[model samples]
Target: MCGLSADKIQVATGHVEISTITNHYIKTSSTYQKQLLELGNMDSINSLEVNKLKEIIMLQNQEILRLKERLNLENEEQTKNANLNGSKNEFKGVVA
Candidate 1:
């Protein structure tokens, strides 16, 4: 029952793969077979390629977060400096 439930959830997740669809019709040497051939096979990319791509994405995300923190700190400092310079100056002989 657990296996059947798992299959149901798997199917519901919409993981219908291209290979599953391809095999369904390719036995007839259908036009789709030629199309798939032109598009190349999905079996080409290995686990290492996927892992490298994921690592690059993770690195980019970390860099973005670091930059955002730096910008926030700079903005806070600018606001503090602006407040310090924005106050009224002391009255001199020009006072009426």
Candidate 2:
């Protein structure tokens, strides 16, 4: 007895009847226990995969931010250079 009542087990397991859980699941067969263990392992494996994907997405987002910053810096530099050239051209016209 795992301390839970049959009714509780039936509700948790979503079985239609308490007798079904008592007859089918409450008895300990090695194969059933093994399957349960496998299910638990699968849950852990899926969690690990999800964590890995989240890390990858974070890295990608950081890279995108870095590229955007670099692009903005380049654009600012080009604008500054264009303004400098225009001023020089105007000064040359006045002198000539």
Candidate 3:
């Protein structure tokens, strides 16, 4: 019973963490978009700054995608684990 409760708590925490990450991603994305827009309008913007910003944005996007994929995989694995626990002791049986 406690294990189930703990699992629930862990899942809830993951969801909350993901939500926080998403909000942060949205905020950062908007800020970067504004920066990109400014780059288009400003003739004095440094090329080095533009390149750095582009690098950071690329890295951030990759990190966000990786986190999202991990979250989804965790959710899928947990759900599958729960479904396989009933009336069986063996794990990871072939899915039909």
- Compare the candidates by lDDT and give the number of the best one: 2
Q: Which ten residues in a row are the worst by lDDT in model 2?
A: 21-30
Tens-place lDDT per residue, model 2, 3-78, is 6778888878899976688777686577887978877778777888889999999999999999999999999999
Q: TM-scores across all candidates?
A: 0.49, 0.57, 0.43
lDDT of 1: 0.64
lDDT of 3 by residue, 1-96 (tens): 233443454465564554454454334477887988887877655777778899999999999999999999999999898877853555335442
List pairs with backbone clashes in candidate 1: none
Runs off by more than 4 Å, candidate 3: 1-45, 87-96
Clashes of 3: 0
lDDT of 3 at 39: 76
1-96: candidate 1 lDDT, tens digit per residue: 233443454465554664543344225266866867755654545556878899999999999999999999999999988876664332333363
Worst 10 residues of 1 by lDDT: 87-96
The most accurate candidate by TM-score is 2
